[model samples]
Target: MKLLFNLLAFTALIFTTAANADISENSLAPQKEANFAQNYLDRFMQRDFDYVMSLIDTEVAGTISPEKLEEMHGYLPSGKLLSTELIGSQVKVINDNWEGSFTFEYHFEDGWALASAYMIRTEGKISIAGFSVYNTPDSQKELNRFSLSNKPLGHYLVLTMAIIFPVFILVTLVTCIRTPVQKRKWLWILFILFSVGAIKLNWTTGAYHIKLFSFQLFGGGAVSASEHAPLILTAGFPLGAIIFWFKRRSLIGQKKKTQKSQTELKESDNSV
Candidate 1:
């Protein structure tokens, strides 16, 4: 009778263990869905196009070229991946399959961070349903945050500087040309010619477009002052003006001191 009771107790224990295991797996299933969405993002950044393509639904993949697919989803941003975070995710049931939307934020080597969205479906596993190519809403928000339109003070200051700079250069050239000393005048003229020529070359090539209302200067249509040539031209004028003003002040002070000393010496000689 004791042996029969022991056998019954052992069978109950086995059944209990199995039930617990099943419950544990059921609890993990939701988490696995989130993980699959995250893993898809990781593989895309890793440039595992083959694995990524395999995950896409055949109907979706049929509509786009493989080359275009890679271009849209690959790590088009150059540099090392600094870090990645899963910001949010949503999953819904559609015709017995899972549809998931995931947002991931990535910080790249260049210190630029962007959020990417992945839309996918899963039949026991996840597959790409669709994805944003360029200018996703998150990306547009980021661009707007850095846009000149958002920075009123900086935008106006740049505009003011751009207008003042060319006028300042022209004034300096006129001063040099009008000087009476023949040798000094010619040398100044040559220097102004070369300098203005270089500045114009940079302005034309740097492709900086300074816009205030309807007027466009430097780069036409849609170029910013941050471009190489525009940057140089933008910075050069203001910096040169500062240096020239200070140097001229020093020269004038020295000339006044020299003239005062000479006047005192001549008076002293006359007294003697």
Candidate 2:
């Protein structure tokens, strides 16, 4: 009976080990795809053309020569990445090859942008062969609401909110002790306007184009430049303003404290 029990325990152990191995393999599949995507993006951003080419399948590489690839890479600026987030992703197997589709949101010095790329596996390495904008139908609707061609409405709205919002916040915080009532009202109004304008701009400029106009006289570059300007002005300007306000407030507080201490010292001397 003891020998039979030992035999059963050994069988259970074998099954458990096999189950764990299968689970681990399943988990690593998605993680491998995610890492491959990240590596490709990192290399591309660094302008490592040789490394990028090495990852591609020989068939795909034959379609685009090294010279053309280098030229294509030259078009992109060495942008400083502010932040990156993987929004959503999926992977599928097609005839012994794996394909991964991922959406990434990137914030740069210029502005915020979104991208989706398809990575195909060939000979144990993943390569990016195609990409497209990841904007949904709902995103398009929001962009239409901010149509710049229609009138000065979009232009004025963007500019006014960019300037007014930061200025209002800074002024209110600085003068809160002196003009509390007026500051409170302006702060509330500015907060609402800023939120609306930010959402409108985000939808309009889904992602800043890395490759501008290869097709026509208008060129992709033209649209990219045009869209990027407002984004930088709206987001970048406010960020800088906030930093300046904080620094200025710190200085003002220190000065007031120094003056108060000086007054106290003088009063103490008089009493003595």
Candidate 3:
């Protein structure tokens, strides 16, 4: 009985080991495809057109000539390849044909990167199926620095003034029409003129080119001369409005005080 039980246990262990080995090999299959896809992409980006075309599917290669492929690469963004990393991949098997695709992020100098690659397999051999270039977000380090830099200050100034001045004009127009204070109306007109100056600046820089059609404005995001202008313009409206509000209130207070004193003096004189 002891011998039989030991034999059974040994057989089960061998089966388990074989099953685990098979599972590991199956799981690693996709990773292998992904690596091949990355390699194909690297070769193409390096301008090794012959080597890349050799690995492509025969049918696909027939459709894309060597000259057309070179032309496509010529239009790609001008930058040195920094690095490439495989992000994800997909594989499918249908009717004896294997299709595999890999997505990779290609990082480049000057905060440039794109994610695009695909691989396919025919008769158990992997080959480059497709390639795409999609824009990726700027790195946080560069985005923060450029968005805050003083160069884009004018862009921000134009954007802020563009957004706020319209509301400022509306409020001013309403006040001028409804109020009897002609003196204050002129001051409001001056504010309107200041707003107009901002609009003009924005127009010259093409701020409305984006904000007019789409509410999503890049403002002064890119590295440019007016990068810091956005920051200043962001604060300009509220600060200017607050200061003007207080000054107008004080003027109104003084006017009322003068009128009250004059009335009291006339009453005293009449009684006398």
Candidate 4:
């Protein structure tokens, strides 16, 4: 029993190690990359457009003119740079190439801007890929939450469906569980758990998209990448649940026929 316990513990450790190896980390950039990013930003704020262009990849630099880079820089919040903080950094390594993005919050005397820099590493060479600066925070909380003002008719309709569709599915599920169906009742339960078609609505923009082939598990719900990200409301038709309810009576009838047939066979056997 001691040997068996040791073997089980070893197996669990191996499985845990393998699982941990696959999870990506939002790690800090390599020292070289970090220095390059900071220096580029420093030059950017100093309005030294020439030095910034030199750090960009040759292909990207060819596409950007001095005048265009100046125009893009003009969009950044205007003020003296008070401080800079690295808000987030994450990198994806694909074979020999590294793709990463670093976002910094630059605080100025007047305002703040979220500046993001994309970098690529290939064959031991690193260069700036792209950059963007947003003076206004691109967050869901910054916009309206539950108000229905000025929304399109479809958004309103889909939002209403999203609100009530899950309750309808739950009611049907409870009814299915209570119904008297003898054979393969679990199959019916699984079938009743999926929604067949979907309508998606953007909570912030109020834009909507419809998909006829979408199959959503557990029916209608809302999902978002982060708290700062916009909530996406999805409402799909509970076709499976509806079908189960429609044929439940037939299923019960089949079960009764099966039971009656068995009883008749037992009665005939008693005469022998």
The candidate that achieves the highest TM-score relative to the unseen native structure: 4
The clash numbers for all candidates, in the given order, read 3, 5, 13, 0
lDDT of each: 0.47, 0.48, 0.51, 0.71
Worst 10 residues of 2 by lDDT: 215-224
Per-residue lDDT over 183-240 for candidate 3, one digit per residue giving the tens place of the 0 to 100 score: 5567654543332111223222334332222121111112122221211221123333
Candidate 2 lDDT over 73-98, as tens digits, reads 55433457776656557778878988
Candidate 2 Cα outliers beyond 4 Å, as residue runs: 1-29, 74-79, 114-116, 122-125, 131-272
**Tens-digit lDDT track for model 1 on 36-149?**
766776776676778777777777888656687677754356678776655445567768866666555566665444444455544565567765533222332243332334
TM-scores of the candidates are 0.36, 0.35, 0.38, 0.74
In candidate 1 the C-alpha lDDT for residue 129 amounts to 72
- Give the lowest summed-lDDT range of ten residues in model 1: 220-229
Per lDDT, the best of the predicted structures is 4
Give lDDT tens digits, candidate 4, residues 1-272.
Answer: 45445534554464345323322112445656766677787788788987888778877777878888788777777678787866556778878889878777677777677777889987888788888766754322355244567877877777678756665666666777777887777887787777888988877877778899988765676665433345677888988888987898898898899899999999999978
lDDT of 3: 0.51
Q: In what order do the candidates fall by TM-score, top score first?
A: 4, 3, 1, 2
For candidate 1, report its TM-score: 0.36
